[model samples]
Target: MTHIRKAVFPVAGLGTRFLPATKSVPKELLPLVDRPLIQYAVDEARAAGIEEFIFVSAPGKTALEDYFCAHAALERQLADKGKTDLIERLAPTRMPEAALTIIRQDMPRGLGHAVSLARRLVGDEPFAVLLPDDVIRAPKAALAQMVQAHARTGGHMVATMQVPRAQVSAYGILDCDEDAARGRLLRARGLVEKPRPECAPSTQAVIGRYILMPDIFDRLERQGPGAGGEIQLTDAINADVETVGVTGYAFDGERFDCGSIQGFVEATLAFALDRPELAAGLRARIDRLAGNDRFAA
Candidate 1:
């Protein structure tokens, strides 16, 4: 089995949803509690054993690149203050310094186009693609689980979760049969890009994590615009499954769709309430909301 060594992160999109907040700052840099969104994605990739990081960024993302850069001054200042623990916590976020490579996506072509920009950097090897906007928090990171599934099955692996029948229209739905061995696992026969609720093949929707084979580059290269005039990753993945087999791993994780306003708020509350340090405060706040007398009927 080919071990996936590289991962592509598409950070080129203009975060229009977040508006003024994301105007000066990239959406990937949005803070989730204490850590930046991109940090969570990078940490997840590292846990999945990815050695090389290829980020597809745009003009205003120098700050994003700088965030991962070594902070010699900060380290020295921490050392002077005897803040050894703080320095240690940040040290892992710095990858050998050279492991990270950035590519500029000249335009907001699409997710597939952003990934295609990393082909030269990825160099014909299997690579993982993670959408930082969809942060999944669990005991075992979602990407790590996908990699393990990739090792088991030589083909591509897509992380999936159960979506309500009415909500299937919002995601890239999958067509599959129940795995004989694993109840959650599915043998993905095909993928449909945001099918209508009535037209969706199955309720199993593909999430943001994917372990793709190099053949996807070719598909993306020739793939036409679907939802918009931009090349979609769903088209490429679906193309591969049409010719070859693809597998879906029911990820054992809780996903926070930070792409939208409601989802981001929910993610914030979930993450904050789960922390032992802040659970009490969060509970108190929730209790106040529940018992507020202002809205009583």
Candidate 2:
């Protein structure tokens, strides 16, 4: 099996959900504690043996590229101050600078269109698509799990999780053949993008991680808008699954939907508690706030 060396991150949309905070800053650069949201996704891809990084970005996103680039002046300043420890932290992200590339989406066409734009860059090779908004914390990185599954299955793989029945319509719902047995992989029958609650086949929603074959570009090119006026990635994936088949990896991970405000707060809290350096201070602050609110009440 060929090792999947590239990963694409579609980050061009205007973060209307985040409003003023994202007005000047891209949402991917938002902090999940000390690291930006994009860094978590990058770390996962790196863990999965992805050597090339392709970021589909737009204006005001130079900072995103810069985040992964070496800061010569900053490194020198840290070194001169005898701050070798601080400099070490920035070293890894700077290595193999050529491994990174940025492409512009230019408009908010849709997820499928954003991915289609990468076809020329990913010609004839399998690639991973990781949505930074889905900040997954797991024993095994979600994309890595999908990559391993794809090697065996040799088809498209999408990371999935069971959502509440009522919440199914809010996600890209999957229709699976029940006769299919369960394992590390699954064969998807069809896919629906934001289907109505009554119309959705199963609550097994597509969580933002995918390992796609290059053939998806052909599907996306002709895929039209199903729900909104913009093309949907689910439609293209679903179209391909009819013949290519899709494996739903019920990924072993605590999935955080950082695409929304509540989800972002939840991810921040979960990630912070796991950190040895930040946990104690954050715990104390939380305890003090709870006590103060109780006293006032």
Candidate 3:
């Protein structure tokens, strides 16, 4: 069994939805509370024992790369100022010099194409891919749970969540057979991207986390443009349903879709409230706002 030592982060998306703010700063760098979105994803991956980090980035994403880079001058300044707490806070952001790899994806193809670009670095090992847009808050890191599941069953594994029937079309719906023995585990028979609600096979939807085998590289390479003339990763995974086999694990977590404005605001408040320092102030504000009928509407 290949331990999931490496993790891939697809950060090449332009984040057109955020527009002006993302135009200058990579959306992954946008702060949820104080830490950037990408930082949270990296922290989660680290908790799962992922040793190497690979980022699929685009031209304007230099800020994302720099965020992980060492800032020696700033560190020295903090030390001189006796700001030990600040230094410790920044410690988690540092990575060993050789542990990070960034691959540039010039064209805004699709998730499949972006993932395929990492083939040279990922090589033959089964690796994990995390989309930073989905910020999941859970007792145990979501990827860690999936990694544990992969240890039991050696095929590809993806994190799934039960979405409302009406919202099924917004995600990659999993067509699965329930594992009688393991309640949360599902044997993925197929995957459909943004299918009509009536056409959805199951309410279980594929989220941003994926632990996939190396064979998926070949599948994505051979898969032509799908849906919106862009290669879809779901299409590649679906193609290998019979051969490679895919499994879905319904993760225990609250997933916030940071890709949308509403979700972003909600996630900010959720994460802020999670911190011991911010909970009281935020909760009081929430109470005050709830009292205002105009705000309620």
Winning model by lDDT: 3
> Would you list the C-alpha lDDT of every candidate in the order shown?
0.86, 0.86, 0.91
What lDDT tens digits, residue by residue, belong to model 2 across residues 140-252? 88888888878888778888998888898788877885457477566788888788888888778898999899989889887778667888888888888767778888888
Per-residue alpha-carbon lDDT of candidate 1 for residues 1-297, written as tens digits (9 for 90 to 100) = 328889999898888999999989889888888788899999999988888899999986898888888899999999999999999988766877589999998988889999989888887778999999999989998888888777768677789998998999889988886545275568877888888999887888898998888888888888888778988988888878856568888999899889898888898888888899999988988788779888554
Assess candidate 1 and give its lDDT.
0.86
TM-score on alpha carbons, each prediction: 0.94, 0.94, 0.97
Q: State each model's C-alpha RMSD to the native.
A: 1.9, 2.0, 1.4
Segments of candidate 1 deviating more than 4 angstroms: 179-181, 295-297
Once superposed on the true structure, which residue ranges of model 2 sit more than 4 Å away at CA? 177-179, 292-297
As a whole number from 0 to 100, the lDDT of residue 267 in candidate 3 is 95
Model 2 per-residue lDDT at 290: 79
Per-candidate clashes come to 0, 0, 0
